[model samples]
Target: MGSANVASTLVYMAERCTSMRYLKLIHAHAYRTCLHQHTVVLGKLFRFVAVSPFGDLSYAHNMFDQMPHPSTFFYNILIRAHSHSTTPSFSTLFFNRMRQNGVAPDEFSFTFLLKSRSFTTPFVYDTHGAVFKFGFSRHLHVQNTLIHLYAVGGVTLSAGRVFEDALKVGLDVDVVSWSGLLVAHVRAGELDVARKIFDEMPLRDVVSWTTMLSGYSQAKRPREALALFQEMRFAGVWPDEVTVLSVITACAELGDGEMGRMVHRFVDENGFGWMVALCNALIDMYGKCGCLEEAWCVFHRMKRKSLITWNAMMMVCANHGNADDAFRLFEWMIDSRVVPDGVTVLALLVAYAHKGLIDEGIRLFESMQRDYGVEPRIEHYGAVVDMLGRSGRLQEAHDLLTSMPIPSNDVIWGALLGACRIYGDVDMGEKVIKKLLELKPNEGGYYILLRDIYVAAGRTVEANEMRQAMLASGARKTPGYSWVEA
Candidate 1:
């Protein structure tokens, strides 16, 4: 076959080789054509095997070893594969092998190594030393990856240092580089630093705006997020699906129905309503804003729904204490053959607990493991405990609390304590109060509950004793406050 045919065959294989069998066929064809050693052919094959769904790093490595003279590109290909694979240590292994084989590394090699999510800080910094030795430290791609690595590793100081070094070396600071530093500060909870970096940037794109908006939302500063989102709009930067999602969430946190409606209209006006993620966020936002009808309309109007869309709709029902509707949605989800996950069951459990459906909640909790294969997490246990306790099944609640596989958290014990007060069982309340105090002796909340129980029972002396204990522990309940928009 001519070289042209061989090149075409390699391109076809790269595009269509979905399974190992197909890869082997291509490998055999390459060998027959004596194109196995061809750099372009081998590079394409190595890259496909490294990332294909049917690709195996071990098999790809063996293929590379068969080459009489493997190029640095082949080594880099394998290194990038292992860097993302579960066995990230293999990346280092292959890097060492490349050095021993006298194959020099390139900028891509160092960047991909740093991109490995599984790398430790010590290993990353050691690799940084290699980047310095190779004199690729100032390579723009390498510097960007370093900042990202430090940012994700929560080593914000190191990321900032790298940024400063880039400035010193006069490397052009691209938007990606600025975004990396912004992310580093945000992850470190230094939003002030993040905001400063954001404001100082000469240019801002949708990404830059979205990053700050997401940072504020995650940090529970919803007002700030909304404010920045408005600034993004006024600056004429178009909001992507991600930006809209963050903005909708901030509106939800504020429970601003008017703002939620405006966002909903904006989504329709901007033709972003087709994105299922944006629609799901709209459902959640409307639900939180007490617009159940609007939330339902969004859910029903969507052309397609992801699992999250269904989950969000169900959560809306659960939030409104509409247990029947929540169950109906769960049934619909099952009929649609969208397998229910732990979050699905969690929402249902909250609904059951909210409506005080003790028997139903218990049945669902038991069925979660057996029927749906969803393991019982701490939140699930808390929901069941709350369900039983609220329905006056104090003994059953306490029995489940004591016998559950996981250690009981304060929510579990607090549920039982509240039940003890409601049932007027002074003896049980006293016993549970001792356990509670042992768990958190300095917690003013539990102390207040115990003292209230004693006072309600006309046990003045015991109430006084509980108050003294609270004073000795230096625990006091801070006054509750509310915000009004008047």
Candidate 2:
């Protein structure tokens, strides 16, 4: 084949190549045809391997290394790929090597580096300096990336300053810029500021809308999030997987199964049923909405499942009092060679507790470290204590608490105190009140529980004294409220 024919053929093959094996075959053909030395052809192959979803980054790096003369374009592609890959720090590593090799970074190189999750604070500042020194600081894309980076790192102030400066100077601001600022405010927990920015935006993309929705969700304003999701749909903006997931979460928080089912239908109609993240969100939505049967159906139908899948399903079962089912699913998970993490162990313990299986819960708590290699944390200890206390084994629970390897926190102590009230052990209840008062004198819960215990035991005078103590302690009972969708 002529050189032109060979290069054209390689390009055509690279475009259509889906498998690495096919790409390798084409590379061998290029090598035999003496076209492997061509930078354009090599760049295409490198781009395909670096950016394509089917591409392997390690293979791309190996091929890049084999090139006798790597171009700046090839270096940027590799850096960009690494920035988004699992090991984002490799982007900086490659950039440093590029600098050592005297390959000056283009605007794209710095832009990708700025988006890296692994960039340290000092490194970000240094890159900021480099952007100015290289005269790319004025580049709109680079500035937007800097805003995003700062926002993601929880440095909202710096991001806001950058965005404000850009707008003050009348720099060409786009949806991304506005969205970044909005997200930065959301990350900083400045919800009102974020909403103002959202309202002021000249144009809002799906990302902009989604950011506001997520901000509302994060702020625990599920009602507002759902309202925003409806507004987004009414605006005719197509919801992506992320937007759909956020909406489902809002429905979960609202415990609105009707809304959740609507989102589920939308997901299925939009062909996101195969997206694992979205499916997982569906499972969570159903579970949170008190639809355990629907959640299990989704779980069983999932062709590909992650560890999170098992944990979520198990938790839902445990929460709904399906302890035997949760344990059976856990056994099946172990049989399938899916290694259980701490979440899985915790869920099973919760299941045991829900069923009031004190002995089984204790055995599992003790065996977690030995069998699953998952060490018990304070939360696990609390669960075991709560379980034993709920089972009316007050002394055993107290003994376990006293013998705990870790110091007991207010949660564990409260668990025991709660049991003291349930079992009406005035002696133990009074002792618990003394310790609880010393630990947290300001808490109204311990005082209220003690007062209830005294009243239940027919000690009206002591109950009156406890009530007076509560009043003098300056601790007021916080009002409790519940929500239901009309």
Candidate 3:
């Protein structure tokens, strides 16, 4: 065969290669043909092994090593592949090796390298400097990546500088640049700044809208998120799965069954019903909205269920006090070969807690790691503590709290304090109050709870003392608020 034909044939075989065994056979044939020396042939083989589901990075690395002289293209393929892998650091290693091999790195090299570091590492700063040294600072793709890297690291100042530098140089700053800056501000907890950037973008893409929408959702400003979704729709920007997922989450947070159903209908109409994540989000939205039947409907209709899907449904049952149903779902989940995770066990514990089945809840908590290989997290500890506290097992609850491998948080301490208020255990209340104050000294609610415990116990002088202490500490009770769809 001509060299071109030989390369073409090998590329075809590489594309058709399904398993490692088949890939190895093809490699052996290429070696026998002496065509393996060709970079084109090796490139195809490396890509197949690097990217295919059954692909092995080790095998690809071996193929790369055997290359007499790998080109920048080959190094980039390796770098890009590793950028998405568990060891993203390998991408940087490959880039360094590329430099050592005297292969000049291109914009793509910097893009992939930036992706690998997760921006948490100081390595990102070195890569940023390299972009300037290599004179790719003006490269749009590379600049976008630098913007993203800085933004994701919560370095809003650096991200903004990169963004403005691009604009200053008359580089066409695209939505990616705008979104990256927006994300930087969002990560820094500056939603208003992110919104201003979002509004200032000359062109808005799905990603730009979704990033802003998600910022609102994550910041616990669901009303703004939903309102932004409406604006996205009016602006004729179609939402992708991620955008809809954010909308569903916002609806869940608002506990707006009506809005959730509207989003669900949109998901169905847009053919996004096939997404397992969307289904999971819908189930969660329905559950939070107090629409148990609707939540179950979404769960039951899902043709493919992830562990999260089952966990969401189980939590729905737990949240709504459906202990029997939660347990039944656990059995069904196990029967279907879906192993329970920490969240699953937490849901069951929550269900047991709601039903006042303290013993059962404790038993499940104890056996979670041994039986399901799901180690108990602080959440499990909190659920069990709440369970025991609800049953007036104050001493046991206190013992569990102190014995917890992880430090108890304010929420767990608050749960125990509430129980103290219920049972009029002034002594226990004092102990819990001490711990709560250590955790959240400025939280007036805990002070109020302790005062209420004193009042209930007819210790008016102590109650008055707590009020005075609260005032002295300049801790104001947070005003309560409620939310409705309207």
Candidate 4:
């Protein structure tokens, strides 16, 4: 027991691994001892994730299934992980899977699940059944979840039904319930009704203010959101990370850097340093607000910077076309042991490809599987095709196209056709046009690309024939798109 306890403590400490190599070593040791299951600490989840990093939801599902006796707690952890960087469906699918396994859900399960399903997928019926099945229909938390599910799930009428049910059952109609309905009302474009609920609530928290602020913000009521934000601040309700995140997002959309700076001061004064999410949000806010220096400062200051943190920061470099700086940061990120996933790869590849750095693109791409253990997904493949096609190595691009196990889809074909126009390979262009026509027989753009290739090669007859085919297909390309960079 002592040995197991000591090992668990060690596993807990391993979650603090600052270096990627150390994280991998800790991950290996934990997996060797099967501490992922035996160790009940939440940090084990991070270990499982560190060993089995991004773009693979299958591993998380597999581990969850292998657990000796999975609890709601573990299920919640896995569900949230699966939900993010993917879809809410990941969480909902597993929730159903858990039911099939005869594990009853608790209030927390419904809460998280409801939170994941944001005003989408009509789960009100299933949710109601789950409540009755679990005999938690009368439980305040369950009712709160039911209200949340319908309100967020976009079934405004159904949410009202749940609220009516809450009233009939004499359940405690507290702030949470009203908040859900208020959000629903606001979502249904009933901001006036939402405001009514806000005024009627006997008590309000920072979340209440944040909710109204978000509602107003989304509805283009920034003045109202800011006004309510001021009113809430005067009410002495301490703002939370949620409030800060929402306000920062709003400020970014409006390009309100000064307002964002005000929020930043509040965040700093409140000493919310441990909230890594807020830290990342601060970085994102500054980046969007055109404060890259401040964004960089926040990124380095963050005690914990998730993959998104790196991606967000990397994007600023990518946008500036600071290819050298972007590549430098990307190299530093991978060297520091941060696992590069599809987003990381795609962004950096774009920078390299735009800069005509073909060698660098291929090297980094090949290292995905050989060095990083990340299987190249379709997105990665698309980036390579785009990179090579744009660099005028159409033949190399065409050769590489045949090697992918995945079919050469529209994206690849589009890149090839684009390269055809740039490099004017009429023969390859003609061949690719057939492939494109086969896929999009009615798409006028394919014929236009073929015509453009022929024109560039001074093959007037071929260009005229392709134009005739466009007339035959009754498909026409939209006006040439303008690409202006400041």
Better of 2 and 4 by TM-score: 2
Task: Please tell me which model should have the higher TM-score, number 2 or number 3.
Answer: 3
Candidate 4 accuracy as lDDT = 0.74
What range of 10 consecutive residues in model 3 has the weakest lDDT sum? 477-486
Error of 3 at 175 (Å): 2.1
TM-scores of the models, in the given order? 0.87, 0.86, 0.89, 0.58
lDDT of each: 0.84, 0.85, 0.89, 0.74
RMSD values, in order shown? 4.0, 4.3, 3.9, 11.9
Runs in model 4 lying further than 4 Å from the true structure: 1-142, 151-157, 166-174, 182-239, 247-266, 284-291, 330-339, 407-412, 430-450, 458-486
Worst 10 residues of 1 by lDDT: 477-486
User: After best superposition, candidate 4 residue 392: deviation in angstroms?
Assistant: 0.9
Error in Å for residue 174 of model 3:
1.9
Total residue pair clashes for candidate 3: 0
Candidate 2 regions with alpha-carbon error over 4 angstroms: 14-36, 48-71, 85-87, 93-103, 121-123, 331-337, 460-473, 480-486
Report the lDDT tens digits of candidate 1 across residue range 1-486.
Answer: 688787787867767778888887888888888788777787777778887768877788788878887778887887888877888877787788989999999998888777763364354788888889999978989998989888876789999999999989999989989988998898899999899999998888898899899999988999999999889989999998888888899999999889888888999999998999889989998989999999999999998999998899998898799989999999999999999888899899888877877788889899888999989988888878777777878778778887888777776798889988887777777877787878877677787777777778889788789778878989766355111111
- Model 2 TM-score, all chains together: 0.86
lDDT of 1 at 67: 81
CA lDDT, candidate 4, residue 301: 81
lDDT of 2 by residue, 1-486 (tens): 689988998988888889888888888888988898787778778788888988888899899889776767888898899887887788888888888899888889889888774354354777877788877867789889888888776678888888877777678989999888888888889889889999999999999999989888877799999999999989999989888888888888889999999999998888899988888888888988899889988998899998989899998999899999999999899888999999998899899999888798899999999999998888898888889888888888878877888877887889999999999988888887887888888887788788888878999889889878888989766455111112
Which residue pairs clash within candidate 4?
Answer: 119-152
